[model samples]
Target chain A: MRNRQKTEKDTPLGAEAAQRRHRAVLVILAAALILCLLLSFTLGRYPVPLRELLGILAAKLGLPVEPFWTRQMELAVWNIRLPRVLLSVLVGASLAAAGAGFQGVFQNPMASPDVLGASAGAGFGAALALLLDLSNSLVTLLAFGMSLLTVALVFLIGRYVKGDRLVGLVLSGIIIGSLCQSATSFIKLVADPTNKLPQITYWLMGSLSGASWRDVRLAVLPMLLGLALLLLSRWQINVLTMGDDEARSLGVNAPRVRARIILCSTLLTASAVSVSGMIGWVGLVIPHMMRRIAGSDYRYLMGASVLGGGIFLLAVDNLSRTVSESGIPIGILTAFIGAPFFIWLITGRVDHYDG
Target chain B: MTVEVEHLAFAYDEKPVLTDVSFTAREGQFLSILGPNGAGKSTLFRCILGLQTKYTGSVRIGGTDTKTLSPREMAGLVAYIPQSSRPTFNYSVFDIVLMGASRKLSPFRAPSREDNERCRWALEKVGISHLAQRCFHRLSGGEQQLVMIARALMQDAPVLMMDEPTANLDYGNQLLVMRQAKALTKEGYTVIQTTHAPEQSYLFSDRILALSGGRIIQDGPPAEVLTGETVETLYGISVRVVSLENDKMRVCMPINII
Candidate 1:
């Protein structure tokens, strides 16, 4: 008889290999994140060596102090670079988590939080705030609110179309994004070109320039809430990647899960946008890097994306400061680095999208 | 556990797909839904699985109304393998099968050792344990189908609903999948499968439900329901149904038609 053998006691290596790879990737990402944070703290116009940076941080924490404490170095490291680095890490983690969640929910690697008009909506809200000269807190609130509202609008429109949710959602996002961009331009056109317009344009280009302890405090609630929600929803995201029908069969209330993920992702995107303006590429590239490194399991993928994104943006922000006499927009630097890397990744792994 | 569907009515927009369809599958019975294309068999499966909420019907599992159960609870009772689904990403065969246990595991929890064992067991049951490490999309169509069935088995649900499980397989693989599905029924799974092959329904199914234009036109043992007249009426083609020694029937198209 042919080996119609149905039973085999042999355990497969796929699961083991996947777990090992995931663990290794997590370790690497954690190490990279720590290294980037340290580098960001150390390297600047006036480069503080690693030892001095550590010494200053330890001294600030009331640890036994190292003898070298210059006021200029103290001011540069603590007052200038620290807040920017912290903000970059927070914003990057937020965008990356949002990207991972969006990709999982939509079952499309191409889907990002910004694809649903969240970023543009936030930009428009920020632009309007600039034109009206709203308070900082109010501007942040308006940006966050409008961002979520835009996603909700896209979701509603997608449902109304009664087709593939990913396609519908993306199409509606494009329409809404254009509308938001036009509104932003109109606001820019109407504002004082010398003052408000330049400020709005610079903000829209995205930076860690104005990042402060206050902005960080304002960002904490939404960022933490969004991350917690994404982490909690990660496993459901596994079933969700199977597409709507299969996910439903696996006992996931598909619409409810999709809505929750979208809400969390939008909140993450909006909060990051509100804090750092419209930094791009971290949301788009970080998740793909995570997926390539850590398999498709969202539990590990989301974690890696969070940490990896944090490190990536922090490094980019550091380069933004050090590369030029006049600091460059962090978003522009991210695009310049991210776009070529993405093209190379895609070209090498064209079969990644086959299934 | 038995599954009962009554007065099922479903529509996409204004056009109806299933209307007043009623059927029942006793515990551990292999029920094959045979129909022509667009005959609403898939719609029926979806309704029973609670995937088609727009349908007006009562679907009961183990005598409990499906509406009373949460999605996870429903999934624990019934597992579904779609006709053909494309994963958007490259997931391992084991990972795909482990998804079947999602209902039993918490959102934050990793698949437990028990879940992993079940996944391995399911893969073995489908005779694809060796393929567990392979990327799902990298597998042949037949292998992918088996992996999906393994996933459904990992659900460990009492009722298994498979839509065209053998549709894309070659002749040998077709028989192989059907044999495995039939074995599932003997293991106490109430299997409901939709297929184009009357031969498969004849050889493996305990009972056959023949659908036509959104209604059950014939329902009985395979030998009784898979008649030449019913086949002709449903498919607009001629077929031959012959009884064998074990009270099993063989269905085949006439030679001239081929």
Candidate 2:
């Protein structure tokens, strides 16, 4: 007489509580992202007041608001700080989302956009443009194109190696990443020691100081499309995290789905790097942290990664301006901040390797 | 459910693995495929599951050709339990069982109401519903095998295909799995299992199909085909079949290696 309708297993009480924790973490990160977006407006060198920032935002959203801000204050807030803040959130979220996707596809805990050579290739392209003294738009275009091309090279190499595609991809990515990194270093060596060298060096170190409305427009569509594709692939990714044979038994085409995921992740990483230079560790560290916060299920991890990444970079960008008047490079800040946080994660880790 | 294979032949890069292999099993019948290593037992299972499609001849389930069924459609008719290989992900047992319903699930969505119900039913059928909240990798070998069984049941296919279902387990767990698999037949499931244990064939299966060197070397009821001479020839070793408990049970043990 076993009435099996409502066994304790039916509800999975422990997993549901874990799921609740994951959802709460996501909600908190999203709320923090919004708060960071609003708070970032009140920061900067020229000092636009919080009230003026709000009035300008309301006016921009097409809401009627009293003109508490002067034209100079409005211009500084609207044309200057707004684009930088928007671009930072967009680029941060894109990199973090792409990193999570790439980690799933590669089936490795250490994977990131930089692991695939996207960020390095984009860095070389930006340095080449600066060496040629090209326009900002041309630098962005070259960086984006070269990043895509570098990943394509990795993909081609992976196809030829012929056993265990994920391993092959990681190998090819390391090779191509080193090659692109050396090329960037070579460009830096040959440039003029005074002007172009410093600019190239600073760009390589990563900064969001010169962001504009045009840069945001150029990167937005591709980044959004990449995020949408990764979000849609979450369930399949859960299946894919099991090995290829298991995925096949479940009627999933592992290679084709893996390719689609790779394409989306590459597009996101490339676009983000082209706009913001090599903002390292946001891609590497954010996804790892999110995996800890939101369990291994990609459904919870992907959304949390996107929002958490935005909040992280938004907070860091604010720190860049606030820690000093001249402002530190965001890449250096990320490394200095990311490395210790990674050590903390390792010390507290519970050895949850997939197998 | 009825499974029919007619002149099924397959080769990998011209090295023939299976040729002229055929069998038929009807509803509630248990067919045990007995073979040594490299006897094409797994290749045959792959061909039936539609994982290897370039083979010649036809595999039919319920009189419908396997070729006409897409992988999703094929999954609706046949389910497989692979030999125990440690999975690489730490997915919970519930999520792993729910994955058996993946063919019907849309991409990027949570499990539907029916999916959850099926998962619960499969867990209860395997009598391991209490383990649903635990991580799959944390389970013991026998429990992991049973979890996979629950997953296959969630597929709700009429025909169940298992490759060496009791390959690596203790004696008690082995009998536990064998008993559960045998019990499914009474519920009108056609179970196709490959096992190295001739005793399992003698004790549990309704029919025995012995394969060697890519062909059906012997086929009949276990009492008729599993003799001392035939068992020796099949395994390339001296073996003895002993009856125990007043002629109600039999056991096969190799007396020598080659």
Candidate 3:
């Protein structure tokens, strides 16, 4: 009687303790993300001091007043830094969410968005658009369309072979990626070497140089929609990771659920790739880092990955712009930072990696 | 609630596995299916679970045709534990059990307080509440089997099905699992288990079903089904069934070269 009452009293307290721990982690991550975003906005060639940059941002957002105002500062803050930071956050969030979903669906931690050739297909489409001197918006649309087509082709090839779906999907991705890379090379070969070649080469290396308000608007909505869908379907994703037979026993329509997840992940990856060209490391590394932090529950795992990925990329983008006299490509900077972190994670004493 | 099957026929890529097979399981009863390696027990289970669409059969759960219910609806009525279960990821014991509550959860809704309470209850029911935080893959074979059973209990269904529930268990764990199955029956839940061990059926099951060549050879009480001739016919080996002092039975296979 008394014992039972005591036990019941302890239950909610324990649960509340767990919830508080989770909230503490979230708050820490939120602070880090804001700090990185602010630093990214301030650290550029025409460096605005942090206090003045905040005043400029507050004024631009229709806040109370401005501390100091100048046309050059306005251009630096609004036209340049703000767009780049916003694009980095959006791309980082999308790629991390996509990677998390892919890893869940494939039941393999090593799986990423690029495993299905979506990035390669998008890269090829963007290169071709560049060779033909197409509009930037038109190139983004073409890249998205080609990515969808490539994913569909992979799915169809998997079905046609009547093989294990994961194996078929991976093999098709490898084949399609090779073909797309060769086609991209062909486009580079035929373009005017003096002009289009360098542009194509830099785009392949990836950049936030052309970040604009239009690009931000183009990416945020779809990426948000995809992330929301993934979050909603996290429980189903949890069951699917247990394998097909167990998933079926748990009342999931395994094939349909997997298809919906693949669609969501590919859509997110395609949007991010289209906007940023091809930022490689965020998709592959962020989810791994989040898994190590939050454990393997997709509910918390997905959220942590989004916050962590956004902050990571913002910091890398800041370094890309400020590290040298001539700005570095965002992709190169990301790899330089991300590769060591990935190696450390892999070589660490984490037992989950055995899977 | 009772499950009824009639005139069940199934084939895989034109190779027939089950032909005109039928059985009925009543509420609060323990039924064991015994068969050789290729006797189509798993295929029949799949058909009843509605996982096999290419079967010609009528399976009814609680007087409703199984074909009419969606997978989620069926899962709300019947819970299945496979013969050998492995976790692909390093999920904790509590996390694995909580997934069984998914059928009752909406896509956007998180697992509620009641859900977590039920998960803890199920883990305690299997005598592994202490292992709730441990990684599932770190457990031994028998412990893993119990955790899987705990996961099935989290479904809160009226019927439970298991394939070879005690296959890899040691002597004590095998008896422990059989006792759990018996306890489930007493709690007003129907249980259907497939096993190769006839002695376990005699010790715990209320009814026994023997299959050969994808067909039912015998279905009756344990005493009537565990005869030497029936065991010989099903397994293609001579066996002896002897009663022990404590209302338990023992099955021994005779030495034969052929």
Candidate 4:
């Protein structure tokens, strides 16, 4: 018995090895995200060299490196390229992490940030702002507020409806989301087709163009808070997937944990959609890909989704700006790219989407 | 540890389920609850587990009222092992077992190194250490049941409450689970299981409680309680209580089949 105890204390072989593999996968994902970050800085309209980019990064961090880059390069890198790239990364990470959280909380593989209608509601908020010719910051603020309001409405309606609580919440989201969609349609119908119509339509299509540092500042706090809370409560998500009765038996307060997850995910989705204007498939597709890569232990899956999302959106955002003289809307590009990639992932792999 | 339930009556919106049920189980005793489908066995278990608080009566564990205990305290008193079912996500067996330690942790805290050690020890005790890295959904039904047993062990509770632990297993697997439960009783842990199988209780349980229509009809040693008449009354199926190997073992066989 003493010998067996010593052996067990050394960490059993199979599970330790598997954990090491999962850790390696997370490390690889982080490395890839860093690489994409560096690449995004250099691949914009006014190309910056790798050396100049490094110098500017060092200078920005208050290192003693001298700037060899021109003033035009500095302005492009710091002002235009920096905020857009950072916002894309932040928005991408938030959406994907929120998607993963929603999927776990709902115990459904197809669940995403939009599953609760945050995106649809934010779209309506942004449309109304555009039609009213509100300031850009007001558009973002209103979108964030209205997005949260929509989910609150869903939860309120869900409380009164009968049957399964999860089904009720999803049904309410669907109903309210369509309601917001038609409202946006009415806004479009009344606006001038020459100017206001095009503006509202472009905002709904989702873009990162003209993203300023102020926009990044506006979104950073809520996005970071949501991500931090989700990461802290990561293991609870795994417990919840066993179903509420089992979770309760395991000593977790299922309803409380579920509420925290939904609130955090809503914060993430609302903030991301408000700034980026309804970027869709990053939340849906990146998490599924991360599940294939990291396996489904939420401890690792949550971090993987965050990093995987940043890499995917950073890469896609680069493509959006540089692929043509006129930048394509990110929402259009995400669906255009995400759909076929998702199909290939599902078909090429012998995996099922139970979670 | 001792469990005492007194005058436990429960109703769902005016429809009575379990009525005036009372029982006591001490440590190291293997208690089997035999009842027909919809006999309120599940509702009784739910009340004891503190999942249903609407029941009228007192449930005490280790002489403390269960009503006053927090969920974490309740988990520390008794661990629940549900019948094997596939989860939505295919979590690794180690991760699933580690979750049993959540009661000892705060909501935001992950399992510590000590918790992981306990989890490994529990898996080894359950003789499924080899499956620690395997995905839960990929395991066989018997193996899944053992995994759940390991999880309960990781809970480090004094009593283990199982909901039909061997319900869907084959004959060999059923015996395997029963032997494990019996062994737990020998280790001085209270083992309470609910099942429809009378012969299983006859072979393994130290005491049997026969429940019919939300009431306890009989409670005693298996030999005193699992008679031919009691079996017929519980299940409404006539059966012959057959003795094997000089009454060393008992088996129930149904009679009057068309």
List ranges where model 3 is wrong by over 4 Å.
A1-20, A352-355
lDDT of each: 0.85, 0.84, 0.83, 0.89
Each model's TM-score, in the order given? Answer: 0.94, 0.91, 0.94, 0.95
DockQ of 2: 0.42
lDDT of 1 by residue, A239-344 (tens): 8999888998887788888889999899999999988888888998999988777877886898998998899899888888888867899988989999999998
Q: Which regions of candidate 1 are displaced past 4 Å?
A: A1-14, A350-355, B12-14, B242-249, B254-258
**Top-lDDT candidate index:** 4
Clashing pairs for predicted structure model 3, backbone only: none
Q: Candidate 4 overall Cα lDDT vs. reference?
A: 0.89
Clashes counted in candidate 4 amount to 0
Write the candidate numbers in order of decreasing lDDT: 4, 1, 2, 3
Each model's DockQ score: 0.54, 0.42, 0.47, 0.48
**Per-residue alpha-carbon lDDT of candidate 4 for residues A1-355, written as tens digits (9 for 90 to 100):** 4454344446556566666778899999999988888888778579888899989878999999877889888889999999999999999999999999999999998999998889999999999999999999999999999999999999899888898888999999999999999999999999999999999999998899878999899999999999999999989999998888788888898888999999999999999999989898999999899989888889889999999999999899999988987899888999999999999887875432222
Better of 2 and 4 by DockQ: 4
> Where does candidate 4 stray beyond 4 Å?
A1-11, A350-355
TM-score of chain B of each: 0.93, 0.95, 0.95, 0.97
lDDT of 3 at A208: 81
Q: Between 2 and 3, whose TM-score is larger? A: 3
